[model samples]
Target: MFLEREEYAILRSHVHADSVDLVDALAATGLRWSEMAALPPRDLTLHGSRPMLRVQRAWKRIDGGKALGAPKTKRSRRTLVLSPYLVQPFKRNCAGKQPNDFVFTAPEGGAWDSGGFYHAWTRAVSTMRVGRPRSPPRPVTASPNDRVSTTSVTRPQSHDLSHTHASWLIAKKVPLPGIQARLGHESITTTVDRYGHPLAMLDDEIIEAIEWSMNPMAA
Candidate 1:
């Protein structure tokens, strides 16, 4: 499930202010929540000509709880260039922290736990689509003639941002191999299987590009 740019903007608004950066970063970088949650100040290079985020570690499930460990796959350990728009947010998260300090934290402090974030995400999406939560279904006890109206909306998992990221890249015509590498897919086939088709909305853009390529007037 991919969200258009403006739709993403609305979803971002529904998340907590402290989590806004994390949400934006996820949409921007395609980092898995575990990789993102485990990011440290040292992992980000927010200055210089090429600002980037280094994904080396992730929070992995352990017997009792979880621990910082290698990512699920070696390919998942990769570097992602940051768009200029994310520079300030990344830098802001990096400031006043030691190299090992967590970059994205909960409002009360400490690294974010996945389970804890679910409630916030649920609430945000519940109201995000209709600008309010859906109405409950009518109880069986209600009269047969009673009206039962409810709003139906998609509650996309936060991980959907990863797919959304790939779609955005596809829209921009970023090469499949490049996107595969950026997304750290273990195999190019995974990337192809997931996002091979260009979005229908891009047909016009594709035509325009083809025309420009055939003409010397393209600048």
Candidate 2:
């Protein structure tokens, strides 16, 4: 898992349903930060055995700014399994909300203000002091052509959570195809390219299997 045990504890304590949905969206779907931000409540299909979160578009960062656009690739327009743990909370958050609502909208009923999200992230990370690093400052450069103002306070890149989820799958011996599907990766190659290494158990399994196989001859 990308979150250390302590980090999970801190997040569990401090993060509300919306924040947890954000994390689950990343960990389960391997969506980029921008993709998560663009999630529409209408995309949630609750009729399935496992509810699916449809990703219709992803926000793009261009010319030093970001905005919603067609999905970067056809592969990006896939559905993801909404984890069971998140379903109830997500339902609660969406109670009486509009169908087109942004799933992780600000509590004020508006799209998340990036600056505010970063600020809240900073505050949350600050509370999780043990083995967790402080949030970094946002980088700023003059962009007179840019419409979206860059974040003033830098936030740590959160994609590490994707890596963590992938690693957990590999460590748990989940098949590659399954991981690729859950991650909504276009190909197993993408999954392998990003998180291909097996966990410590890979070697241990090989050695233990070898020993067991050889020991049978001694019986």
List the RMSD of every prediction in angstroms: 5.4, 9.3
TM-score, model 1 to reference: 0.81
Model 1, 1-219: lDDT tens digits are: 777788898888888777788889999999999999999999889889999889999999999889999988989999999999999998898889999989988878898989877777787887677233356777979998988777654467889899989999988878878999899999999997887564565678879999999999887
Each prediction's Cα lDDT score? Answer: 0.86, 0.67
lDDT of 2 by residue, 1-219 (tens): 255545555654665554666665566666777777777778887665788788887778789987788776777777777667667756766677788777777766677767766766666655654343344433488355656543333323466667766776787787778877666677878877777454454778778778988896743
What's model 1's lDDT at 210?
A: 96
Clash count in backbone of candidate 2: 3
Candidate 2, residue 61: lDDT: 74
Which residue pairs collide, candidate 2? Answer: 137-154, 138-153, 138-154
Per-residue lDDT value at 130 in model 1: 26
User: Worst lDDT window (10 residues) for model 2?
Assistant: 148-157
List ranges where model 1 is wrong by over 4 Å: 130-151, 197-219
TM-score per candidate: 0.81, 0.70
